[model samples]
Target: MKVLFSSWLGEVVDNRGKPPESWSDCPAVTLPDTFGKDRPMSAFIGWGGVVVLNESYDIVETAYKYAQALQASSCAKCFPCRVGTKVMEDTLYKILEGNGSDSDLVQLETLCGSISSNSKCGIGQLGPGPIKDTLDHFKADYQAYISGGKKRPNYHYPYKMTAPCTSACPTGMDIPLYIEQIKEENFAGSMATIREASPMASSLGRACFHPCENNCRRDNVEKSLAICKLKRFAWDYENTHEVDMPLNPNKHTREERIAIIGSGIAGCVTAYNLALMGYRPVIFEKLTRPGGVQLTGIPQYRIPLESLDAEIKFLEGIGVEFVCNVTFGKDETFQTLRQKGYKAIVLATGADLSKGMRTEGEDQGYEGYYGGIGILKKIKYENAEIPKYKTVLTVGAGNTAMDCCRTFARLGSNSYIVYRRTEKELPCDPHEYAESLDEGVKYMFLEAPKRIVAENGKVVGLESVKMELGEPDDSGRRRPVPIEGSDHVIEADCIISAIGQDPDIFYMGDEPKIKLNKWDNPVIDEDTMQVIGVPDVFAAGDCAMGPETLVIASGHGRRAAQSIDQYIRGEEIHLSDEQIMENIIRKIGAYNKNEKVPNPKGWERQPIPICDRDKKLSSFEEVELGYTQEQAMEEAARCMRCYIVGMACVISDSEGGE
Candidate 1:
């Protein structure tokens, strides 16, 4: 990208006096040239150095705005950061007011050094970097402002605060803030902070595949902080103490009723947030209970029933009603819901229809053939009678496959996981894979199912073929290639196909207005979660996006609730400025895995306790015992509070303008 001036991450390219044709491109800095839509970005001042995209940008004003933003974001944790940022902001304002001096320039430089070296967090430590760069590269601009040679540019500066962990989070959770609250022993404050982003605290605390821990800055020093466990601790503390979970003061204040289909994580979170916003939300679930995939697909050993029940009970307390044994498009159509006076409809029916492993005799009426979701639903939800099988083979290598094999193993069957890829390519969580092995679940790697060998239209064995890895597939995983003439049969009385799942949009029932993608998932606005052609209808979770993690689904649910509320209020459905900034920082890459952290090492992550091994294999009891208060506090203290300020200078008429 062409730039007038750039000093990002030690790569400098100055084209102040060069012709446009003779200018050099920025070597390292790569930033968005435009803000929202087509609004040209003048400059970007962030934790990294400055990148001036437009030469007409007023450098002096940009620096002053960045200083002001930095001061506003300061946590006031220490003397150096709080006082130093204030002094910097005051000096810049004085210069902007045409009263600057050479001594003031020198003072600004000194203050930057002090703040960078002594601040308690990244907000102060990295905040002064771009200002220092401006002093070194654009000093004449500051001098011109002070000497009355240049007037104010009045460019709008929009800023946002982010951390490595928060930026990587799908929900944009304030991870550092909540962890800091835990460190202060204020568990309620931490839970409140988490609730700001999501209300599935207990369920997510147990079943969520936490992506925040992977980007934790603490990993540089020791291991990543036990983020997921700490979240569980906060929720467990509130539940065990019998403290009433706080409700939104404006709960049920609004009269418009919203209908949400499916009581999965996405649907539940959407109802929870809408209720908090004073809107009445009714969740329609097909099963006998409210929890959708949590109760149907996930094994009870991972997420306890009581934890999920408590979450639903709290939602009820906030005026969110749950109607069970009601299926969308079956029991109530969109037309029927509208006739019933529902202001908006949310389709959160998760992708629970398990895909079949294309094999011969698979679709035959074999009594033992079952989908991964089907068996889990039968075992966990229906409480149906279990058929005794000598050997149970589950096909696939994802978390569902692990859950399937583990659950069957607990049922006293010789369970086996058959996969086409090696163990290194197993897609399940490492901890889950390890536990499955400990429970005597065997693995058959480099083998793919070819056919289901059945006798008398009943159960039998699974014919397999030897496989090898080929070129990488669309998912970045090597494609499995079957070796010729390598078919073999694995003895099994029952076969569960756990390959994958997709949204069962059969409920849409010939609705042409709601568009769908090639994958049969709904095509909705990514930001607002509003269905494209139908503004009053919204979709989230696996039905909106393809099958994703619980936290991601919850994030979608929160966004959907906001959009639904706006739709009912006759307001524009859009993302907030903070949400826009989050997208920008995410595009710029927040977590630098190779960046050096200055904190001391040796603070090992606390381990979560486990249930008895005997109970783990024989029963569906909870496996992970949540962290105690002492462990939670020690783990929280390991957070480095890596908060940084990001700001953009755009045209006053731009969407990002303040």
Candidate 2:
């Protein structure tokens, strides 16, 4: 087997005046005697080393063969490697075929960097060696391919800022990291990393609003990978199947007791993490069961009761004691818990109270005007009897509205969403909204409910006015203004207001121990989440954050736990700006300093399961079924590890540190 390596460059492997026809023609190029059994000699391609085989098997075809082999042989551990390899090979082919641009060379190098740095194991780590070697030793090949018999572009832009996707994640989750993991079939490892930052890996995987996807480099390719939903796959597996989480032992224990109120995702996570730090932490829940809204608000269809219960059980197993049906302010006061020998108190009572439209006839005999929280509570309780309504109208465009509409559909109610803005302006996730629409929920966009009309002391209809988007509002969303002479009426048997919710602070007396905001949420130091006046009193979760997602609330719990640990240890409770800057620099280091490459292609995103539209609307047995094990493994294969094995350091020989 002989091969002729082609490039405008002078270097070519020649067998005594006859150019080699294949890599096998060159004996000087060493091939490993044996590799993984699944992988054989035919699977190998090109010279494997840069320093050793500097120019052997340097042909682009041989490199392509090696690249393809890697694309196939890779455990698919990380995104950049699994996907990036295919992309890099494609880009290389274009360059070889004379369709290459100056940017193509830059993209090839960028993919090379990603593959080298983000891949897990030897195959990925060494996969890019040939391309890099060719680029370094046979630079003329890349130059000739891109230059089209001309010169390369000058003054490439440098110093691009950190991407927004990575910036928005709380735990600094490698958004791109696990995407590659999904590509690699390393579902277990990917899920383990997710659990490091969040205990509710399954919940977050399904429901997290992935800001990472928004900033995805792939969105520049096609659409961003459904990053959050992919996370759901890993978590769904961990929940359904047994997964191991090795507990990190911390021997240092402080003789302090911390009281965390609510026992929801936030409270439970806080208490669980606190226990891991050797603190005797107890969670107080006002409800009969723990999990707060996770128990009483999120419907069984979205967050299955078994999954929620399993997570709560795991927290309990980890030494987080839950005191259910014990109202913090009602049964025990802040002073009482403190006097009971507790050193700190964490308030995670979520925003469970629904916000009313405050319209007239609301308190009257009108059957309309269902409170958002109240409706969710009813469905979660699993009572057979539901309020029989012919036509139901919901007010709001947030996730609550979507939840309300879905629940209404399951309850045999013909549901319609009356929002103050267009579909683009709806606050709900696009996927959730799409699911709601699929389940037969009608949407009346650019309309707001004006009043609930009733006949003979019974709710009959809803009156709404058409709305037009005006200038950008303070919320950074386009403001919705009523359109003149566009008043509309929607008939309704029951009206559900899913606008929003408010925190109930009446239980906390008018004391200076904890400061309260005008909105009735506890005012706390932004960093510590500790009530300003009450150093020992930490606040987290929905009520603390003024109503956010379960994931953000969990992040709050994690942060508060760390802060509380610092407080108990009498250490400075602040993250230095230098530390923050260094972290930002690390992510920047992950990205290519040069041109951006096209995202890896040839794999479709794992599809979330959905019941038949009619079936979905008629019952509450979870609309979108979770990912199967095979699906999860396929998805996990896509995550780019992004973990650099060895830390980069500057050696100083003068200090004898070299």
Segments of candidate 1 deviating more than 4 angstroms: 1-3, 15-30, 653-658
TM-score for all predictions? 0.96, 0.71
Cα-based lDDT at residue 46, candidate 1: 87
Off by over 4 Å in 2: 1-166, 174-188, 242-254, 382-384, 484-488, 576-579, 582-595, 640-658
How far off is model 1, as Cα RMSD? 1.9
- RMSD, each candidate, Å? 1.9, 14.4
Q: Model 1, 1-658: lDDT tens per residue?
A: 7888888776788989888888898866667767765566788888878888877698888888899898899989888989999999999988988889989999999999999999989988989998999999998888897788666768878889999888888878899999999999989999999988988888888988888888888898879988888889999999899675787787889999999999999999999899999999999998889998888888899887888898889889877899998977778889999999999999999999899898999889798999999999999888889898889999998989999999999999999999999998999988889999999999999999989999998878999999999999998989999999999889899999999998889977546888788999888889999999998899999999888899999999999999998899899898876777788888877777877889888989998999999998899999999988998998898888999888888877434222
lDDT of 2: 0.66
For model 2, give the 10-residue run with minimal summed lDDT.
Answer: 152-161
lDDT string for model 2 (136-243, tens) is 555665666666654222111111112334445665565555656666667777766666667777667655666566555444444456677777777676666666
Q: Which lDDT value does model 2 have at 108?
A: 73
What C-alpha lDDT do the candidate models reach, one value each?
0.88, 0.66
